[model samples]
Target chain A: MRAIVIQAPHDIRVREVPDPTIQQPTDVVLRVLRSCVCGSDLWAYRGESARRPGQRIGHEFLGIVEEAGHEVNGFAPGDLVVVPFRWSDGTCAYCAEGLTTSCPQGGFWGSVGSDGGQGEAVRVPFADGTLVKLPSAAATDDRLLTALLALSDVLGTGHHAAVGAGVRPGSTVAVVGDGAVGLCGVMAAKRLGAGRIIALGRHSARTDIARTFGATDVVAERGDAALAAVRELTRGEGAHCVIEAVGTEQSMRTAIGVVRDGGAIGYVGVPHGSGTGLDLDAMFDRNITLRGGVAPVRAYIPELLPDVLDGTIDPSPVFDLTVGLDGVADGYKAMDERTALKVLIKP
Target chain B: MRAIVIQAPHDIRVREVPDPTIQQPTDVVLRVLRSCVCGSDLWAYRGESARRPGQRIGHEFLGIVEEAGHEVNGFAPGDLVVVPFRWSDGTCAYCAEGLTTSCPQGGFWGSVGSDGGQGEAVRVPFADGTLVKLPSAAATDDRLLTALLALSDVLGTGHHAAVGAGVRPGSTVAVVGDGAVGLCGVMAAKRLGAGRIIALGRHSARTDIARTFGATDVVAERGDAALAAVRELTRGEGAHCVIEAVGTEQSMRTAIGVVRDGGAIGYVGVPHGSGTGLDLDAMFDRNITLRGGVAPVRAYIPELLPDVLDGTIDPSPVFDLTVGLDGVADGYKAMDERTALKVLIKP
Candidate 1:
């Protein structure tokens, strides 16, 4: 099987790897139909994250069940499913609370001991806890495939930010970033009945997508200017909710600054950078809620799947480019150079 | 007139001072009947916070309105009132949202340019927004005065912690501290209908007060030991809500440590140390909510006052020591030594 592997910084390759087999009673094997590049992947690709030679990469995938372990229930071969970024045992206390991302038995894809998702086939641990089965009609709908693939990561993460910030009817939300995840955050806020959506980013192309995703206003400013613009839009009170999708210290601070006192800032970006400290002094005095970590994509997948299936939302626009598995390096380049919002790899 | 003045760390004195008079159209003069030394006041008393040689000190008070400014309405001479720690213009956007502590025109008592509450008379700015008037019968009700005084700071702050953490029916709450504010947190959790209340502190006397205030369990351990105890109580999942009343980094970390994933930590202790940073790495992955600052006492006073007056809650027990204005230094010493949970000063 051909899989994506990082040989070194700025070096991605598609090499033949052994096919995965079910190793545990609850494990299943999946034939990945589609996999996408995540923003976190860029950290390693740019030589920022700790990556060793020949490391398997990627965590987001839409796939078909190729084999199932004996303990797996409600799933069999040929079933289409959305695979969350992490695998978990469904019955743990954290899983029972719908926080699969924090499940004690959970482990990330493409890590030291686990098979990566950007491959022709991979072994999935805790199959019953990690996969959300889609209706049979999904197999025949090419137009819906990209959006379904997004459910594996970015879109669900955006939803997590919105819900974490307590977005509801009449909420004024400020989404800090215009990346694929940030654009999706705009859509999530709209779906949750946010009355005003402000997208903060400088790139015209990304901001355009943000508008399409239901952003009511776009502020192409940084630092104090961006904070001022959000305050201006919100009648000097700042947004009722802020969705932080960029995992930088400055992005988190901007999200905190533009949120009204007693409001919330929901952050979904994987934290990066050195010395990224939340200013407890400011957060304490403002009574602002800072909530959000990794998204529980498994928990959110079920609730959001029906909406995608019914054509109520199409998150496909986030994928600006698509390529064959052989073009995987260019896919990473396109995203790295900011020429594409996201790159989809058809395996 | 006389007022409590801090000449230096550990030096408290009641000295002759100029009588307070209205300085703004919205100001009102109040004859303070009672004032209390707060945990935060000890910070200044210990020379931790900025304090000047002749600075007026207390901020928690129950008083009788002796004079009203022309613009002040619904309050007049001889009306008893509960004065919050801060004052605000009732019409600001934050005030409208019930976040009076963050009101644009708000300022804390004893702060530069503001009169403190320990004086015989105080010129209260934003009288309509800062003072909650009690029924005239309050003057004759001796038993209710201490409880009413608690509404000014500690009790209201505890309530803020519980409410900020979103305490609700069936919520399992862990209170970190057993000071006056922490004991009050137990009561606040009870008032909010928390099913199981865990008080984390080592003092037997304070724990007794915590039990009386409705703590179902008391964990006297500190650091990781305390975390283990809380985990043991909640079936290894941690508590649904954690109220952090101690401002140290270790206390903050313990609160974060014991909170279940997707749970909240409501902190009200005034931050004292430099570089008190929340580990966003841990918080981001666990999806914990860190909220709380200064309590919006004015916003909460209305809802809590009736219960105190009706004998439904006896917050007076928290004030274990009583002193006259001349004994202000002893009041600070007693609390500093942990010999008294709190001290009430009769002006």
Candidate 2:
């Protein structure tokens, strides 16, 4: 089986790896149809995150069930499904609460001792719990397939940011990034009926997508200028909700600055490095509601799948570049060089 | 007129001061009837917060409106009122949104250039906005006076904590302090119909009052042990809500530790000192909702006053020590020595 592996910093390769086997009754084999390069992957690709030599990398994919374990139910071989970034036991208390990301028995794809998603095949644990089955019609719908694949991670994460920030009808939302997730956040806010959607980004191409994704305003500014622009747009009261999609100290600070009193910040950036601290005094005095973490993609996939299937939304545009399994390195390069919004890989 | 003044660290005195008079069209002179030592007062009393020599101290008080300015409405001389710790213009966007503590035109009492509450007479700005009028029956009711006084800060703050944490009829709440505000939080949780209340504190007297205030359980532990006890009590799922009343890193961490996935933490403690950073990675991964800040006492006073007046809750027990204006120094000393759970000063 050909799989994406990181041989070293900036060294992405596609190499033959042993095929995954069903080792447990709750496990099933998946024939990955699509995988993608994530902004988060840049952490390890750029040697910013710790990784062993030749480590399997990637955590988002859509596939067909090649084989099912004996205990798996409601799903079988030949079924198309969307795989969440994390696998969880559906019965855990956290999972029951729709926080499958925090499930006690949850495991992340490509994490230590776990299977990776960017491969020809994957051994999915808790198969029934982690895979959202797609209808047979999905097999022939290429456009819906791209949108469905997004439910595996980026789109679901953007939705989490919006929901966590309490975006609702008439809400004024500020998305503090223009990456694929940020653009999706703008789309999510618009879908949730936000009255005003502001996207803060520096790049022209990304901001253009942000506008297309329903951003009512785009500020190609940084630091105090961005904060001032949001405040001025919001009548100096700040936005009702701020979605922080960029995981950086500066981005979080900006989000905090542009949120109104009694408003909230839904941050979905995976924090990296140190000196990233919250201004507790400011957060407290402003009465800000800070809520966000990892997205429970599996929990949200079921709810979002119908919207995609019905063509209410098409997040497929986020994938600006596509390649074959052997071109995984080029996919990483396109994203790293800021030439591609996101890259999709075909197996 | 005589007033409580801070001459130096640990040095509190009753010194002769000029009589207060209505100074602005929106100002009114308040004849303070009752003031108290707050946990936050310790910060200034212990030299932790910057204070000028002979600075007016204290911010919580119940008073009689001695005189009303021409612009003041809904209040007049002889009317009893409860003054929130911070004064706010009722018409500000934040104030109108029920976030009075974050009002753009708000100012904290006892702060530089502001009138302090612990005095024989004090000029109050935004009298119509900051003062919650009490019924004539409160004048002769000493019992109700004590309960009403709590509404100025501790009780309202506790209510904010509970409400911030989303405590409801079936919620299991864990309060992380045993001071006045913490005890009030326990009481607020009970009033809000929390099914179970766990209090974390080390003092026997405070914990005893905690039980009396409606804590279902008390853990005289800190750090990991405290978290373990709460998790054990909740059958390993942790509480549905956690109220962090002590603004320390350890307390915040414990509150986060004992909160169930998808649960919330309502913190009200004035974050003092540094090195208090959030575990963003942990908070993000766990999907915890961290919402809190300075309590909007004015927003809650109207809702809670009826419960206190009708004897539904007796928060007066929290004021275990009482003193006259002349005994102001002793009041501070008793609280500083931890010999009194709370000090009530009759001016």
Lowest-sum lDDT 10-residue window in model 1 chain A: A273-282
Q: What lDDT tens digits, residue by residue, belong to model 1 across residues B217-276?
A: 999998899999999999987998999898987888888889988899888888864225
lDDT per residue as tens, model 2, A71-183: 99968999999999999989887788788988888898888777788889999999877888899788788878888899999999999999989999999999987888888
Give the C-alpha lDDT of model 1. 0.88
TM-score of every candidate = 0.97, 0.98
Residue-by-residue lDDT tens digits, candidate 1, A1-347: 99999999999999998889989979899999889899889999999898879899999998899999999997899999889999989999789879999988999999987878888988999999889998867877877988899899999999999998889999999998788889889999999999999999999888888888889999988999998998999888888899999888888888888998898988898898412546768877888888888999899988888888888878999998998888889999999999888999888
Runs in model 1 deviating more than 4 A are A274-277, B274-277
Return the lDDT, model 2, position A218.
Answer: 89
The per-model DockQ list reads 0.66, 0.70
Clashing pairs in 1: A284-B293, A293-B284
Best by DockQ: 2
Q: What TM-score does structure 2 among the candidates reach?
A: 0.98
Candidate 1, which CAPRI tier?
Answer: medium
Chain B vs. true chain B: TM-score for each candidate? 0.97, 0.97
